[model samples]
Target: MKNDVKIRNEMLSWYDAHARVLPWRSKPSERPDPYYVWLSEVMLQQTTVQAVVPYFEKFISIWPTVHDLASATQDDVLREWAGLGYYSRARNLYKCAQAIVSEHDGIFPNSVKTLKSLSGIGDYTSAAIASIAFDIPSVVIDGNVERVISRLHRIDAPLPDSKTIIREYAQNLFIGDNTDRPSCFAQSLMDLGATICTPKSPKCEICPISKYCVAFEHCDAQVYPKKRKKSKIPEKYGVAYIYVHDGKVGIEKRPEKGMLAGMVGFPTSEWNEDSVDNIDDDMSAYKIRHVFTHFALTLYPQIINQKTYNMIEFKEVDKIGLPTLFKKVWNMIESDL
Candidate 1:
C-alpha cells in the first residue's frame, strides 16, 4: 500500500486556504469546544450543514453548555429542534446531555470508546468528536470523505458494501504522522469532498488533490463511491383534524414511540397504507404531502370550528415545535383561516 504523506500534505494545505467558516467549527488558531462540536455533529446527522447553522446557533444561545442542556426539558429541546428533521436525534441528544451531566460531571469524554457509550453517539460521531474536539488522531469517515477516498483510489465498489474498504483506506491515510494536526487532516478530507469532489458534477479542474486521484486520471471522478438504486418508497395516508375556536387551535401529543414521538401535532386519523373513505367536502380544507426516510405521506387536513377540545392560542403555535410534516400541513391551511 502506498503512503498518504503527499496526499495529506496537499489536502491540508488546500484546506488551510479554503476551509468553510462554519458556526460550530474553530479556526486553526483556536481550540474547538467539545460542546459545540458534539451539538453540531448530532444536528448534522441526516441533515445538511446549511440547515444546521441556525439551529446550532439557537441551541447554543439557549443552552450554552452541556449542563444547561441537561437541565433543559426534553420537550423544550424538541421544540428548539423543530423543522430540523430526524426527531430521534433530539431525544438522544437530551438523554446524552443528562448522562454526561449526571455520570461524567458534565464533561464530554474525549475518547471514542467512552463517547460511544453516550446516547445517540455512534462510531462516526465519536470519531468526529474525538478528532475535531480533542485533537485525537481517530479515523473519521463521513459521506464526503468516503466519496473523496473512493475517487482517489478509483474504487468501483458500491457504498455500504464498499464502506469497509473505504474505512480501511481512510485509516491508512491518517496513519503517517502524529505531529500534523489530526483535526485539520480529518476536516480537510471532509472539506475536499464537500466542495470539490461533490456527488454530482465535481469541480475537478480546481481540485487540489486532483493530481493524486485515480478517478480523475480515467476522467470519471464523479463515478466513485457508487450507491445502489433506492427501493420504492411506499405511500402512507392520514387525515388531520384541525379544531379551532376563540383564536386557539387544538393540538395533541403524539405517543412517546414511533414517528414524531412526544411531539405536538393536530389530532389526526391513523396513518395507514390504505386511503380513508367518506371524507366530507367542508372538512377537507387542504392536502399536503411529506416524505420521511422510509415512506411518503399524504395528509388530508380537515378544519373544524369548535371549542370543545383544549387548545393552544394560534399566536403561540411556534412553541409547540411541531415536526416538519405537521408544520407543512399547518402552513397550507393556516392561510385560509
Candidate 2:
C-alpha cells in the first residue's frame, strides 16, 4: 500500500505539470461546471478527442446552458449532431438535459447517485460529473483508466468484462478525502493511459509510474489487457432507392427508434443475402459497401429515373445533411450518373 501511495503521488505530480489543456478543465479560482463536464463526457463516448473537439465547441456555443439545451427542438439538436454518429447518444443527451431541467431545476446533480438517475447518465458519466463538477470523492474508470490499471497491475482478463475488476482495483487505490481533487486525479490517469501507457507501443521511458507498473517492468504492457477475439460480422445486403427529379434527391427520415434513428437517409429496406426482386422503373443498379462499428453493410443503389416516381422531393445534394453511410450511397449515385 505504501508503494501504491508513492505511485499515486508521483502520477498526480506528473499530471499537475503535464496535463493537457482541454476545454473542460477549470481555470484557477474557478469551480468546474457540472454542465460542461456532463456534456463533454456524453460527447466523448466512443469518440476520439480530435473528432469530438469541434462537436463539443459547437454544442457549447449553440446551447450554452443546460436550460438552453433542454428547451431546444429535437430536430435542431439532431441536426447539430448530424455527423457525430451514434444518434442515440444525441437523443439521450437531449433527454438528459430535459431531465435535469424538470427534475433538478436545470442544475446538474452533484452526487453520483443523483447524476446516474438522469437519462443516459451511466456509472462512468456519473462519476465523471460528480468528481469534476462538484469536486466530490468518486472514482472514474473510463477505458483509458481501465487500460492503465490493467497494465499497472498486470491483470490479464479480457476487456469489457474485465472492467469490473479493474474498477474495483481503481476504487481501492483512490485517495478520496473530503476535499480530494478527484477531477485532476481522474483526468491525470486518463491522460497517462492515453498518452504514455497507450494500448500499443507504450512510452514507458517517460512514464512517471514506470517504476511501479508491473507490465512495464515485465515488458508486457501490450499483453496485459487481453481482448477477446472479435467474431466476423456477417455481410448484410440492402437497397437504397435513389430517386432523382429536377436536380434534387429524395430522402426520408428514419424511424424515431433503432439504427440511424431520426436522421435523414436514403430510402432503404431490410437487408437480405439475396438480390431484391420485382425491378420497378428504369433504374440502374450500383453497388457500395460500408462497415459500421459492429456490422458490415452492402448497399445496392437502385437509381430510379425521375420520370417514374412522383413522390419525391429534390434539393441540391450539397445542401443536404446525410449520414456518413448514406453519403457513400450518394457519392456512388453521382459518380455512376
Candidate 3:
C-alpha cells in the first residue's frame, strides 16, 4: 500500500494510452461534460457498457442538454429508455433533469451531497460525477473498483461485509491533490478491472500494476474478494396475453407501481409462483424464461382472443420499445410464424 505513487502513476500512464473510446468519454486528462457524465453513469448502472452506448448516443442526439431533457415529457423519456431495463431509473432520471433545471438552473451540482439530493443520484453516482465530470477528488467505489482493490490487497473477506474495508483501501489508493488526475484515476480503475483484471482468467502479464498486486504474486488473484455461496433464486410465473389481430400485436402500460412500472409490456395475469398451475398448456402457449436481478420469471405467453388491447405494427414494435422481457415475447411469436 506504500506503493501509491507507483500504482497511480502506472495506472494513469496505461489509461492515457488505452482508455476505451466510449461515446460519452473524454480523454484521460480531459474532462467530459457534466450532463453527459451524469447520464452515462446512470445508464451504465445495472447495465453493460455495450448495451448503453447506442442509448446514450440516442439520448444525446435527442435532448442535447439538461434544459432540453427537463422540457421533455416523462413518457417520451421512458419510451426511449425502454429495453435498457430498470424503468425506475428512467422515471427518476426525468425527475433529476427537472430538478437540475428548476432548482439548479439547469446545471449539475458540483458536490457529492448536492448531487445525491437529486433523483436517482446515489453515493456511487454522485462520486462518479464529482470525480469524472467536475474533477473533484472523491472516492469512487464500484464493483470493478471493489474487485481491483480486493485483489490488490488480497482481501479474503466476501462482498457486502468487505465493502467498507475495500472502500477504505480505494480511498487511500486514490489519495492525492484535487486535480484532473483524480478523474483519470477513477476511470482507470474501471478500465483496468474491465479489460485486464477480468473476473475469469485475468491478463496479469499485460497488467501495468501486476508488480504491485499481492494476489498476482501469490498466483491466485481470482481467489481474492472471496464470495459466499449464492442462495437459490426463486422463480415467479405469469401469463402474457399476446393478443394479435391484423398485422399488429397488443401491448399495455404497466400500473404505476411494482415491477416494470409505467412501461409498455404485454398484458398478463398476476405473477406468482403459485399461478403456474392455473395456466393450462395448449399448443399456442409458449413459455419464455427471463431472469431478473432478484428472481427468475417464467411467462406463459398465449394468443388470447381479447377485445381490450392497444395494437402496434410488428415493424414499429421495436421502435416503440418493449422491455427485454416482452421483446422475448415478440421474438417467440415471430419464430413460430
lDDT of 2 by residue, 37-156 (tens): 888899899878888889889888998999999999888888888878899888899999998899888877788998888778898889988877887778788888888889988987
How much lDDT does each candidate structure score?
0.88, 0.80, 0.87
How many pairs of residues collide in each model? 0, 0, 0
Q: In model 3, what is the error at residue 87, expressed in angstroms?
A: 1.6
TM-score of 1: 0.96
Q: Tens-digit lDDT track for model 1 on 18-73? A: 99999999877889999999999999987788899999999999999999999999
lDDT pick, better of 2 and 3 = 3
Predicted structure with the largest lDDT when compared to the true one:
1
Tens digits of lDDT, candidate 3, 214-307? 9999999977668888998888988888777777778888898999899888898888777566566554368899998888998998785544
Stretches of candidate 3 exceeding 4 Å from the true structure: 28-30, 176-180, 246-248, 275-284, 313-315, 334-337
Best by TM-score: 1
Of 1 and 3, which scores higher on lDDT?
1
Ranking by lDDT: 1, 3, 2
Q: Residue 324 of model 1: what lDDT?
A: 89
For candidate 3, report its TM-score.
Answer: 0.93
Which ranges of candidate 1 are over 4 A from the true structure?
Answer: 176-179, 280-283
Measure candidate 3: CA RMSD.
Answer: 2.1
